[model samples]
Target: MTVRSTAPKDTLGEELVRFDGVVKRFRTSLGRRQTALDGFSMTIPRGSVVGLLGPNGSGKTTALKALLGLVRADAGTIRAFGRQLPEGQALVASRMGALIEGPAFTASLSGERNLRLLGELHGVGAETVAEALELVGLTQAARRPYSGYSLGMKQRLGVAGALLAAPELLVLDEPMNGLDPEAVRDMRALFTRLRDERGMTIVVSSHILAEVELVCDRVTIVRHGTVIRDGPVGELLDRGTVHTVVRVEDVTAARSVLERAGLAVTAAVGPQGPELHVGATAADPGPALLKVLAEHGLYPQELRLRQASLEDVYINAIREADAARGATGAAGDVG
Candidate 1:
């Protein structure tokens, strides 16, 4: 298996990881087959931090496991770099680092020693361990026993261990779990540094949508073991409404006029004054909004446009998937 160096012109960078129509199912003790992945397909671009986001049981971890060869898919091809899965995983794994759900180390050992041990597994030397520790802001705490470190420090150490390999790609699952607000902020900065300095690709699966929006260049959202949406974070979120918030002198008149013009409008007391919350099409909703406001002789003292958040896109995707699944189930029952 070889790494792919060139990406499609349309993508941000090289193609690092790809899952095509992958399927995996687990049989319960009662002999019920639970589908963990159903024809899931996603491509991770190189040198970009790509968020792999989904709710629990949405197969986020399962997808990572398959990509890393920690688990085999019942069906589908998993590729790392350019090499296809299982067969290419070893070669690609060498260029990749992973810190899954929890940090695992000999608790009694010092953080530095634990890193050394992990380094040995990858034939990494002491210098590499030191660099990794320094990179993850663990240099000062490296000599402390793993059990004595704070939860945030432990998370940082886990990240340090992953970096010991100086991998071309890093896979982190809920890396900021158990972190304080400051710690989360620091971790986000570190990921940005990794992308900016090392040009490493990252696949992060996290429940924290806000953090993902801050650090990820793009995102692949999964639900019901399949892709609900995949694209640049900005693009996916922009697919939603462009809300134009206006502070007008008259509330009732503005609302009536805007509503008559087919603009969905709501009102609330905002920081400045009474605000008109208007939902418009994905395109620039400003000009059309102004036209309607001017026609009604309503002038806005303040106007602001609020782009939809990634959370909005995520929740809607899940809702749509649920509706589709319910419809499918209903059709099956009828048959």
Candidate 2:
């Protein structure tokens, strides 16, 4: 099955990381080859917060690890900070920091000591260590042994380590995994501050669609080891077909009124009463829609617009991929 991306071509002069036809492969059980990534290409803009979303076994982690030089790609070129990766990768990676899975720390070491050791490795001074701890809201727990910290606190300490280098690019994989609701909110604020105040570029990978929608400027979705969608979050949201539910006193009359005005109405009974579902256009439906309804004297008691959400898009992409694969298998059997 082939996955075709619907994303538009990105304009020049905006890319920070560029991958052209990148692929990665490994040996699987029974000595068969498995492809983790296939022709994955993308250009992440500088200083932009991009949400990398995919379901389990979708190769999101493989893509990130390739960027960090932890795994080498079998084909294609990856350029970061205007240089080819894994060669000038050291110099380029120095300007980047990441929390790939979770914090790896000595159980006996105090949080502060662990941070100090990381700071030293990154050439960060003592003052920088203190600042990193404060930035992650881990200053109070800085003196406690890492083994005593909760899962959320351990995640925070990992974030602090990532910040210790004061990197230009930060890559986080499920940074909010163990966080509570309040902590998730706090993490959002921290990401905003990092981009607004410090001018940092962030690539966050998560399965939490709503949180990604709230925080990301743009998103790139992958499924079955291929990129399915990539674009501005707002554009994707706006492209959704608007579905409006309307409740009126006269259900039959309401349908006639809306139909005459060229609005598609479906007769479906809602909680309030029989309602009409309107599938509005891709563009704005406000002025023309309201004028038509008002002209017909069908006073709607309730009117609400529903559209596809980030989760909707995510699910559809994966389902489409599965359907394509099923069709291909059927064709192969026929052949």
Highest lDDT model number: 1
When summed lDDT is taken over every stretch of 10 residues in candidate 1, the lowest stretch is: 1-10
Q: Which 10 consecutive positions of candidate 2 have the poorest summed lDDT?
A: 1-10
Native-to-model Cα distance after best TM-score fit, residue 245 in candidate 1, in Å = 4.6
> After best superposition, candidate 1 residue 25: deviation in angstroms?
0.6
Cα RMSD of all models vs. native, in order, equals 5.3, 8.1
Give every collision pair in model 1: none
Choose the strongest candidate by TM-score. 1
Each candidate's number of clashing pairs is 0, 0
Model 1 earns a TM-score of 0.80
* Residue-level lDDT for 78 in candidate 2: 95
Per-model CA lDDT versus the true structure: 0.82, 0.81
Q: Candidate 1: what lDDT? A: 0.82
